[model samples]
Target: MLVDIGTEEGNSWLGHIYNLQGFVQFRLGSTEDALSFFNKAAEAFRQMRRADDGPWLVVNYGNLAWLHHHLGDQAESEAYLSKVDALMKKYPSPSQDELHAETYAEKAWTLMKFSNDRELLADYFQRAIKMQPEMVEWNTSYFLWLVNTSEHRDDGLAANILEKMRVAQEQDPENFCLAACYLEQRGKKREDVKDEARELAVKVLRNPVSSYNGMRAILRVYSNYISIDEAIALAEEALELHPDERYLKRCAALCLKRKIRYFRDRHTNQSMIDRAVSLHEEVISLYPHFSLVKNIDLANIHAKSNNGMAKADQMYQDLLKMDLKPAEKQLLYNQYEKYLNSD
Candidate 1:
């Protein structure tokens, strides 16, 4: 459909479509296909000389650089990166930054979604938000990152973050930002936020935004406030609408795991656990970089099942050998220790 629309819309518009296709293909693990799409987009922009130095071209060049780097073609990667540098120099941003808000936000989101480097993730998000403070999505994401990366629980910090979220929500009441904010507050045991959070969850779920962030926010709300069955149902519904979204798949798998954990003794829950395992395996197969976290969850699920003890033990051993960050290593150790104690 995008290809068809792009064909009818001409080169400038086609460039954008190609860029979108490249991102989708890259997420789907078709790096070569992604490279082709990005290259075609770049060519389209170049042909339209007026747009060759536009912000869109920055995206094309940046994606090409990233794809090349991923493919281990450092020469090609650096060449494409040099193109971005040249473009930035030719068309300087009003803020005197090397990259535009769009580019920063793109990189920030990519890192937030795929990478575990919290410091880099926070820095990129801060850069993007500094430039585009009114962007509700970025604000919501930035808040989430702050909540997640805090080494210790700080009530004052949480309250400050919540106030900022309230300001953002006021600016964009219809956005998913409020849902995220309320959910975060509810998680912190703010009883006053529960009713409001539930209301926002219903509204967001009823009219879910068709974006990755939107889906994640809704899933987070359901996972916390609603029953496991409802969360799974919502995830399945969202998956039907966005069949290619691996994050939604992960959400559904996690929901199922929750159900399994909650009702492990029930015979019916066995099928749910099996299905959750299958989804986790599929996610790992699709994106091996996500394996460590997904595998940890999978190992925990297996540890609870009667027939999966050996496999769970093997997974734990393998995970312990992997080079993990201090926080990640601590989490794994704690979970494994808990499992041992449970036995």
Candidate 2:
């Protein structure tokens, strides 16, 4: 996944990817790759800030300190630790917080990816944005993160939150993903966004493909408001434009799943089921780390298809045999119960 990000994104994001990848490698017990990634992260940060070093390197240096300590190099560890201390003394946090603004921002981004602690995550983002108002991406990313994280909520976003998002969306004109999210929130609040969604869809389709290109979010808006068939068509068009892009594939599959799983009254055709099944299977292959969720989606898709209960049943049984974490096991159990009740 880090390899997919490459260095095409902004310098700060590239450094973030490298830093997270370094930590993942170390956790996997590959100290050499971890060291390499940490060095790459330092360089990326240097390029991002247009300097050799800054408070941004605080986490990088701290990572180095920990890595060296684990490697039994007391001198190296102490040297890196001293570097961290000097950096902190020279460039203290902008706020009363113990961590620098950059550190807070990075921690917020990292934690958002791995955890669901809503209050802690929102607080970190708030601190980072308040301290470093110049970093526009942080604000946009924070808004988008909030929008995405609150997807399963029964109640939609509040008016004040929407107003703040609208302001942020205006400030960062180039972030189409945030724009799509704003539109989605408005639609959820019973606003008329059909024409706006159509225009945004055209613009997103024209833009170069990216992780934050807004296509996925746009598909969601279209699937919910404009037309599910059109959403599937849009996803297919994007996938055709970039066949190897796993993100696009996931988007296509998700659009198809929504159409099949919910809008079954709209011409429940064989080709749609086959396409959804195939796309989910391919998505499972492309993102093995997230297969549990995809696999459950696949099973549900099968259950809704013609004469596919056996395959779906067997898949659920297979998942039951795997050594999943407690959370995943509980989710599977809940979903399975729903699947059985549907019968």
Candidate 3:
């Protein structure tokens, strides 16, 4: 998963990525690979910070100490322990009783990717925020986590989550991703979000193209509140700008699917269904391990078209032959039953 996170160098999260890769390697019992990745993470931090050491290394050092301990190398483990001791003494925690904010922040960030224990991680972010409230990025990440994991509200987020997003938008004024999400929650409340959504589209479009996911969020606002045609146009424009972007293609395909299947109240031409099918097929290939839902979507959309049921049936048969887990088989059968019963 980390291997596909783009090839952009000098990324701020490169060190975190390396550190996480090391952790995953160690978990898989690849001690040598884990050590290599841990060392790479140290080097990544040193190069990015233009320094040999800082509080950021605290977590990396702890990982090394634990790794050596696991390998039964007491001497090397103690060496890393000494380094952690010196770093902690050099940069004491703000509360003296609590951890350094960097450690807490890194812990929160890494665990977000690895663990589903949101309550514990939320506390970590909170501790980090309390120790260093000026870190706007930490604040933004905290609020974003809350927004994503919050209870689903048909019309909008819960009141507390809404307030967090509002505060996050203010703190992260230039974060079009958060801005777009805020617009969606507001739109769900029946507010007039079209103008703001349009303005946000302009800002997101003007920004230099990168791998940031703000564009996806903005597209959601358009898909839900604005015209699906306009949403498709925006998604197509994005795809044209970055034709090789699998993420953008996936988003575009989803937008097209919505217009085809869900928005049947409106006119959808054969050309639209064809584009949807083409996009879904490519996406299915592009993400072979994660394409079950896409396959079902492709089948359903094709089944709705003239003389396309044969392909749909063949796809379903192919899925039936795959060694899906029992839970996956249950889901596939559920969806397949729906498809078979459809007019």
TM-score for each candidate, following the candidate numbering = 0.60, 0.89, 0.84
Write candidate 3's Cα lDDT for 79-185 as tens digits: 99999999999988877678899899998988777789998999999999888887676787776676567526676687777887798789878766678778888
Per-model CA lDDT versus the true structure: 0.69, 0.87, 0.83
Q: For residues 1-343, write the lDDT of model 2, one tens digit per residue.
A: 5544446545347788888999999999999999999999999998888999799999999999999999999999999999999999999875564678898888988887788888988888898899888888889989988888788764568889989999999988777888999999998988889999999988888766766788988998898878998899999998888898887898899888888888887576988999999999999999998899999999999998889999999999999999989999999999989988985
Model 2 clash count equals 0
Ranking by TM-score: 2, 3, 1
Q: How many Å off is the CA of 100 in candidate 1?
A: 5.2
Best by TM-score: 2
Model 1 lDDT at residue 242: 62
Tens digit per residue, CA lDDT, model 1, 144-225: 5565565245342466677786676666665554456446555655444446555665565555333323455556556666
Candidate 3 weakest ten by summed lDDT:
3-12
